[model samples]
Target: MANHPDQPAFPFRRPNPLRPPGEFERLRAHTPMTRVTTRLGDTSWLATRYEDIRSVLSDQRFGPHLHGGAMGWVGEARTGDSLFQDPPGHTRLRRLVSSAFTARRAEEMRPRVREIADSLARAMRDAPRPLDLAAWFGYPLPITVISELLGIPQEDRKQFRAWSDTFLAVSDETLAAAAQAWSDLNAYVVRLIADKRSGTGDDLLHALIAVRDEQEDRLSESELFMMAISLLVGGYATTANAIGIGALHLLHNGQLGALRADPSRVAPAVEEVLRQQAGGGEMRRVAREDVEVGGVAVKAGETVLIPLEAANRDPGQFADPLAFDIGRAPNPHLAFGHGIHFCLGAALARVELQEAFAALADAFPGMRLAVPAEEVGWSVRLLDEGPKGVPVTW
Candidate 1:
């Protein structure tokens, strides 16, 4: 792939905290799939338009695994998890854990989710004014939910949070920390699995253990460990960030008042939040063979980065794409992604977000940001983009 001098650099940061980077819209209008330099100074094709991004993600020809054993961004290597797996391997792995994250299961957990959210909200209400919602409510809600579902002990939840933070660090300076977190998480999972083997529990981890024991040929110990780690990390971080960002959006747009007046609006409000909050990290894929994206020929072994934020805001796909209309109907955002690799925890995340926002609306209808919107810090370490600390007062 030849680098175009006019092409904006890859991994573009949002000029405004709440909106997609300006370069994304410019790229979407001009060159949908253009060559650009990554943060590591490596050239790759960036797919900006909705149709092109969907094509790249849905098509099997563009797999997550890359040549030279690279996966996604530079310095990121392929893990044995399902994220990097393709075809039969991916299918097999997904099948073993799919039952635990099904829509029905997520729905079944709704009451518990509401309970957790309300409890957290009450705790926030009891605390002093100008509290950090991200620390008190946003992170803990999902962390507790996922931990309970996975049967992880409450005492160990903080360690998991720390490990996940380091594991998702994007900068080269934090690469060592990420690696250490990866090692520590794996070791922890191994120990957890060993503990589960000796006794049975009523959690997802125990169910996975049963499958590994009864169907030894189907699931391996290493696969089980990686799957556990994936569920723990992926399950918590994305939802936590979404809750913080979504709350910020509500507080900014006065949507919380509307939600408080009519609580039923929480569902659509959550969907709209998911749509507008789509700007985060990039999804990576490498061409398995020669493929054309947006009329540009992408050769095999070339990297393709799908900008979810750009695709979600494509004018062709969304009307008034940048607006935060809570009642927007027929919203088909690709925040969870598309096709086979679509997020497995999407339903669970939705439940958590819905309950979270609903609880906040009910508990504190007068909640407002304690600081100026611009004063809130955005996380630079993690892949997801959202407020690092949402300071709120009611």
Candidate 2:
């Protein structure tokens, strides 16, 4: 089925594993905001320019709580997904949870998170060559840190990865698996919330449970359930993927040696990674009222999909956008969305990435891709995108 010229359809094939679809540049240059047909045949507006993408997110007129056939089965609860909810409820929930992810809180976690990263690095050092770093190091560090922060029991850590994958399944092809995974995860969280009431601990989950009251400042049972699920999946998945992606890029770009030689560059390097990645999918929303994005008229109830990866790589914003320069300064990329809708866990994510790459580079400065660069498989589970597995050796 051919797509209309005015409405380009996706899945847009990515002929190159590491690069976004080349059409993004063409759209950004000619029509920053144009109508798009999603893979499911739902029509939405696509926003590609850096400035326009930022504007759409920050404007309250472009809201969350998007509903359409494109969101698929997992999005049946999109209204409750903390990432897609609008205020004043979103404002209240964000304010309540902000305490747990404040800069101070993330700083406090650095020592422990670093310890986790170092431990993984040590194990990697001793293991046989050509290990799947994604399995051994990439997924483990963030999963461990998030589990600890959420007060999830040690026994529950393993299943968290599989459960979190539910958010990645945004298409009907995987609807059955997504449904089962979501059901299992939902039941687990409900049980855990019940279990937490009888205990006394200082985890985020405990804090959330204690706030559930009969009065105005309270979270409903469903809100609590959704919040917990969102945190679990959002906390670990992208960071885990980035570890592998960042490592692959660092090696491919020959920046690992520089990073190892100068420890201070790790933080900036992490920012670069996020800028380049911007997650594997577009940020979705619908206009609550009429909105003008880059001079394009977007009517109320119209869906807008912003491919942040494209925005981050916009040459107009970044100098030599494709080059991987660790020292790139004044880099204002929108890998993370802007405005009040900014990511709450941004601080915590930074802590994990900085510590992770520092520890990895320290342990194996010579580490390189085990297979040919082109051989590394990339998977796109709906909106979630990243390397499938990055096998590497020193």
lDDT of each: 0.83, 0.81
The ten-residue window of minimal lDDT in model 2 covers 65-74
Candidate 2 residue 126 Cα shift, in angstroms, is 2.2
Model 2, 1-394: lDDT tens digits are 3356566785477776667788888888898887777766667788888888888778888776444453555556646646457778788888879988999999999999999999999998999988999999999999999999999898888887777666474456666777777778878999999999888899999888888743435687778888898788888888888888898889888788888899989989998888877364556778888888889788898778877888888999999887777888978987667887788888999899999999988888898989876678887764467788899999
Q: How would you encode candidate 1's per-residue C-alpha lDDT over 1-394 as one tens digit per residue?
A: 5555675676777666777788888888888888887765667888889999888889999887432311233233335544557878889988888888889999999999999999999899889998999999999999999999999998899998898787675466666667778778878888888988898789999998899889988888777877887788888888988998898899988789898899889999999898876544556798889998899999999989887878889999899999999998888998888999899999999999989999999999899999877778877544467888999998
Which residue pairs in candidate 1 have backbone atoms (N, alpha carbon, C) closer than 3 angstroms, thus clashing?
A: none
Candidate 2 to truth, TM: 0.94
lDDT score, residue 194, model 1? 91
